[model samples]
Target: MKVYIETYGCALNKGDSYIMMTLLKESGHEIVENYSQADAIILNTCAVRLETEERMKQRIKELRKIGKKLVIAGCLVSSEPALVMNLAPESSLVGAQSVDKIVEAVESPTRRIFLEDSKELITPRVFEGKISIIPIADGCAGDCNFCITKLARKKLRSYPPRSIVNAVKEAITNGAVEIELTAQDTAAYGLDINYSLPELIKDVLEIEGNYMIRIGMMTPELAMKEIDDIIEIMKDRRVYKFLHLPVQSGDDRVLKLMNRKYTVDEYKQLIKEIRNKIPLVNITTDIIIGHPGEDEEAFNNTLGLIKELKFERIHLAMYSIRPNTKSALMPQVPDPVKKERMRIANKVYEDVAYSVHSEYIGSNSLVITTEYGKKGSIIGRTINYIPVIVKDYNKLGDWINVKITEASFFDLRGQLIQ
Candidate 1:
C-alpha cells in the first residue's frame, strides 16, 4: 500500500504522522510524497479552533475528489467523529491515542474507529527535516473552559520516561540537531506518573549527542509548580533558552470565567524569575482575543500586558466557538470586535518584537543550519532559537558563526562572519 500522510496543528500532530509513516514503512508499505500517487490518505487533524476544523473539512472534500481511501486521525477523531464521517463517509478514524493501530486501519476492510485510552507508544519515527518533534505525552492536566481539546484528550497520561529518552537518543543518532519536547501542556508532564520533565531531560542529555531540546508551551499554573527545577534544568548548555508560556488573558474576571487557575500577577512573576536567571531567554506567548466576556476593559488589560511583557513572539488567535465547549455556549464577542482586537494586538506585537529583535543586529553568534529559506536563502537558529536567514545553500546540520545584519518583527538576517 502507498500512504501519504498530511498533518495539521501542533508538533504532536507532526510527530504522530511521522510515527504512522514509520509504522507503514516497517510493514512493507510505501510512503508517497504526493497524495495523487498514493492508495490511501491519512489526515492527522487538529480541532483546537473552529476555523482549523473548517479548513480540515475543505481539505477532506478536496482529497475525496482524488478518489483514494481516507483515514482521519488526531483530536477530531475523539471530539467529533461524526464530523469526519459526515465529511468523508467512507473514511476510517483513528484518534491520537490510537496511533499504534494505524497499520491495522490501513489493512482492515471495515471502517475502523479507535478512541480508547490505551497506553501511549513511542514508535520509531522518520523525521523529514533537521529537527525532530518528540511528543513527551498525550493530553494535559488543564480543563480550560474554552478548550474542546480537553474532551478529546481526556486525562493527562505521561509516556514512560525511558521510551521518551530512547526516542530522543534515536533521533540524535539519525542526525536530528534539534529535538522538540511537545505536548498539550509540557509543564504538566509526569503528573500522572511519579516522574518529572527535568528528570527526563537529564536522562536524554546523558546520551552522547550534539543537539538542543525545545520545550513546548506550558500553562502558567503548572509552570509555577516545578518552575525552580525547570529553570535549573534549562540552564544546561544543550537546552535552548526559550519559553512558550501562554497568558490567555490579563483580566482576572475574564480569566476566572475561562477557568484559568493562575492570576496575571503570578504569570508575570514567573516570567520575571525566568528572565532574571536566564538573561537572554527568548520568551514567547499566546493570546486569544474577544473570548467570552472580554469587553473593552478586558481587551485593554490584554494590550497592557503585551506592552508590559514585550514578548519575543506572540501567537494571537481570534476566539471561535466550537461544537461543544463551555465558552461556545457563552455569549460571544461580536466578529467586528474580535477583528478589531486582533488588529490592535498585531500592531502592539510588531512594535515589541521589532524593538527586541533590533538589539540582535551587529551581534555575532553561532547558528545551526536547520531548514531552507525563501528565495535561495537558508535559515538557521541562534542558541536562543532566534531564526537567522543567510543567503547560502548550507548543509542541513552544518553550523556557522554569522554576524547579524538585519532585524524584523518575524526574524533576523545575517551574513557569514568568515
Candidate 2:
C-alpha cells in the first residue's frame, strides 16, 4: 500500500509521524510524497488552540473528499475524538500515545480507533535531512489554565533512559548531525521514571558522534529545579547553546491566572542565572497577548519584560480559547484590544530581535551547515544556534568559518571564509 502522511504541531508530533512512517514501511507499505499517489492518507493533527483546531477540521474535510482510507492521528484524535468522528465518521482514529498502532489503523478494513498507550519508544530509520527529532517523553507535568495540550497528553510518560540512549545512538549512526530532544516539557522528563534529563543528556553525550544536540522547550518551573545541572551539561561543545524557556505572561497577576506556577521575579532571576553562566546562550521564549484577565497594565508589563530581556526569538500569539480549558470560562479580551496589543507586541519584538541579531555583524564565527536555504543558499547555525545563510556552500553537515556580513530580524547572512 502507498501511504501518504502529513504532520502538524510540535517537534513531538513530527517525531511521531516519523515513527508511523517507519512502521508502515517495515510492514511492506510504501510511503508516498503526495496524497494523490496514496491508497491511504494520515493527517497528524494538532489542536493546541481553537484556531489550530478549526484548521485541522478544515484539512480533514478536504482530505476526506479524496476518498482514500483516511486516518486521523495525534492530539485531535485523543482530545477531540468526537469532533473528528463528526467531521469524518468513516475515518480511522489513532491517538497521540498510540502511534505504534499506526499500521493497524491504516490497514484495518472497517472504521477503527486505536487509543491504547504503548510503553515502547520506536526509533525512526528515516529522518528529515541530516536532522533527527527524538522524543524523550510524552505529556507533561504542568496544569497551566490556558493549555489544551494537557487534555490531549494527560500524563507524564518518560521513555526509559536506555531506550532514549539507543534512539540517540540510532540517530547518530543514521548520519544525523542535529539531534533534537523533544517533549511537551523536556524538563519534566524522567520525573515519572526516576531518571533525570541531565542524566539522559550525559548518556547521549557519551555516544561517539560529531552531531549537535538541541534541547526543546521546557517549563520554567521544572527547569528551575535542575538549572545548574542543565547548564553544566550544556557547557559541552557538542550541545547547542540555546534554551527555550517560555514566559507566557510577564505580569504576576496574569501568571497566577494562567497557573504558570512561577512568579515574574523568579523567572527574571532564572534568566539572570542562565546568562551569567552561559553569556552566549540564545534564549527564545513564547508570549501570549491578551489572555484572559490581561489588562492594559498587564500587557505593558509583558512589553516591558520583552524589551528588558531582548529575546533572540519571540513566538507571539493572541489568546485563542480552547474547549474544556479553565481560561475559556473567563471573560475574553475584546478582539480589537487583542489585535492592537498583538500589533504593539509584534513591533516591540521585531525591534528587539533585530537589535540583538545586529550585534553579530562584522563578527567571525564557526557554523555547521544544517540545511539549504532559498535561492541556492546554504543555511548553517553558530554554536549558539544563530542561523547563518551563505550562498557559496552546498555541503550539508560540514563545519565552515563564516564572516557575518548582514543581519535581519530573523536570520544572518554571511560570506564563507576562505
Q: What TM-score against the true fold does each predicted structure earn?
A: 0.98, 0.99
TM-score of 1: 0.98
Worst 10 residues of 2 by lDDT: 118-127
Which candidate has the highest TM-score of all? 2
Candidate 1 residue spans exceeding 4 A from truth: none
Encode model 2's per-residue lDDT on 168-285: one tens digit a residue: 8987887889999999999999999898899999999999979999999999999999999999999999999999999999999999999999999999999999999999999999
TM-score of 2: 0.99
Question: Residue-wise lDDT of candidate 1 within 34-132, one digit each (tens)?
Answer: 998998989899998988988988988998888778888888887998878888888888987888889888888878887786654764578878899
The clash count of every prediction, one per candidate, is 0, 0
Q: Which of the numbered candidates is closest to the native, going by highest lDDT?
A: 2
Q: How far does residue 19 in candidate 1 sit from its true spot (Å)? A: 1.5
Where does the lowest 10-residue lDDT sum fall in candidate 1?
Answer: 116-125
